[model samples]
Target: MTGTGAALTYTTIAGRHRHEIEVRRSRFIAVLERVESQEQADALLAALRREFHDARHHCSAILIGANREVQRANDDGEPSGTAGAPMLEALTRRETADGRTDLSDVAAVVVRYFGGILLGAGGLVRAYSGSVSQALDTAQYVQRERCGVFQVSAPHATAGRLENDLRGAGLTVRGTTYQPSQVLITVAVADSSAELEVFRERLAGMTAGAADAAHVGCEWVDRV
Candidate 1:
């Protein structure tokens, strides 16, 4: 799916993270993990269930797909819309530092230990949402984007300088290949017509119109 203003990108969790909160003597543990498919999400829930076997309730929410089109929530043993629904809302409404709310390919499971006291529906919603939100606040994030690959061929003597200049200009230098007579410097740019044109212009300026870059392919990459 496309992102803001022709740029295709979304925010997602970097890895697995766990956090716990206590409300009215009950313990809520939130586990957040990156999952690319429904099968992976299911595996995550199964593993958590095995890990916290004695928990009173194990509510879960999963969002899978680049556009976050796959959404699933289970209230488990709690009242309808009290646990899983709020947790899913927390995942959907999370914003990045740059104010983007498109978080995808992730799963959240909230395990609750009853602690003898019964909480009302409203209280349960707040506890579930708060647990996931707090865990998200402490998690590391990365951007998943579709990027274009380009190969810039340069002379062996000046290839190093060209690579350094490309990096200095905030381009991702994927790798360098040594050829018989020249070197191929692989670079990645956002996969948009505007961005590709800009890259061509920047390369021309960097090489003084002496070198050209050929578009190779497009790929999705995670950027920190």
Candidate 2:
């Protein structure tokens, strides 16, 4: 709930990532995964609990929704504020490659195996925070961008070159469909009038007004 306005883009993990660290002889296994809703986040936590059944603590945090409007955490028997809170901070504070701290749709769980020594409150916070940070370091990142979909129809002879030109102009070419008479190229642009206008103008210039692009709605696209 920290940010307002329509969500245009955000960063998230590409898939599950696991990283383990040892502090004061205790093993902290951190698992980070992409979750789109509360149910998915809960499911991930439940699966981890079952997989690491013998672990001493299964602390977890989840940041779901486009603007990270849903944030939840659980100490799971660990000292208050020592495990889950720090883990959540790691996800919210992570910066994408473009330097945006807008990571969302992520769930993090730290499964701790006791090593016979008790870490102080400060030590525990550092351990959990470091575990998640390390896991993020090794995770593959992707950006979820809101884009307007467009279908551009062109002559079959010019489709290949047109596709390359679109990609070269920094547009996302989702795919191309072949037909007996023409080619249908699907492309995505930022979901804004200004972006769409630019795309149309570019298409006109690229095809000498021979090709036409039709707006085909919008959706969230994943970009690595």
Candidate 3:
């Protein structure tokens, strides 16, 4: 119910989303997968290459990083800029909730099965771009959030009641674990100083100083 730490979120493919289309006798199969780093993207490309080895061409484009900062595209023997460029544009220009059109952390691969046809440069561009666009229709996105995680400990008898009370207070309790002498409660909130302060005070009052919170760490987590 407070500041979100000026943290930002980006849009990306939910998981592995696929779509296929035939154009001018050429079959284009597009597969989209979410990836967090260059290594992951490379692995996907390698896997797809082996999976669609029989196809005429296996083109791909990868965009990763919070800023969608990294980009790589390969035409894979197609006309220069015909296959990979258009596909890159299709995925790179996606708009986020805050109006940033730079989509991040998505790997898209297009496999072409030639049907004894020669689609010119223009046609190839359309086919590749269209492949990714169609797959995006059914794609789901997991929003990455910058969250603050903290821990608190309480006596075993009061831990359950404390968790319930924390949840009732509109807190996002990440998890709770039991120990021999006490219980450990972990909670997360928007990454912000204000939110952390609020959490500390709320826990103090709820347990009458019996519960004290400790800052764990911060990272991006998926949210539906």
- Stretches of candidate 3 off by over 4 Å are 1-7, 98-102
Clashing pairs in 2: none
lDDT of 1 by residue, 1-224 (tens): 24575447888898899999999999999999999988998999999999999998999999877778899999998999999999999999999858888898899999999988888999999999999999999999888888988899999999999999999998989999999999999998988879888989999999999999988887778884
Candidate 3's TM-score reads 0.86
Superposed on all Cα atoms, model 2 deviates from the true structure by an RMSD in Å of: 3.2
lDDT of 2: 0.91
Better of 1 and 3 by TM-score: 3
Model 2 reaches what TM-score against the true structure?
Answer: 0.84
Give lDDT tens digits, candidate 3, residues 83-110.
9989999987766567667478899999
- Give the clashing pairs for model 3: 14-140
Q: How far is candidate 1 from the true structure (C-alpha RMSD, Å)?
A: 2.8
lDDT of 3: 0.84
Q: Looking at model 1, which ten-residue stretch has the lowest summed lDDT?
A: 1-10
RMSD, model 3, all Cα superposed? 3.2
Candidate RMSDs in Å, in order, are: 2.8, 3.2, 3.2
**TM-score sort, best first:** 3, 2, 1
* Residue lDDT tens for model 2, 1-224: 11348788888898899999999899999999998988888898899989999998999999987778999988999989999999999889999877889999899999999999989999999999999999999999888888888899988888999999999999999999999999999998988778888999999999998888888888888974
Instruction: Sort all candidates by lDDT, best to worst.
Output: 1, 2, 3
TM-score of each: 0.83, 0.84, 0.86
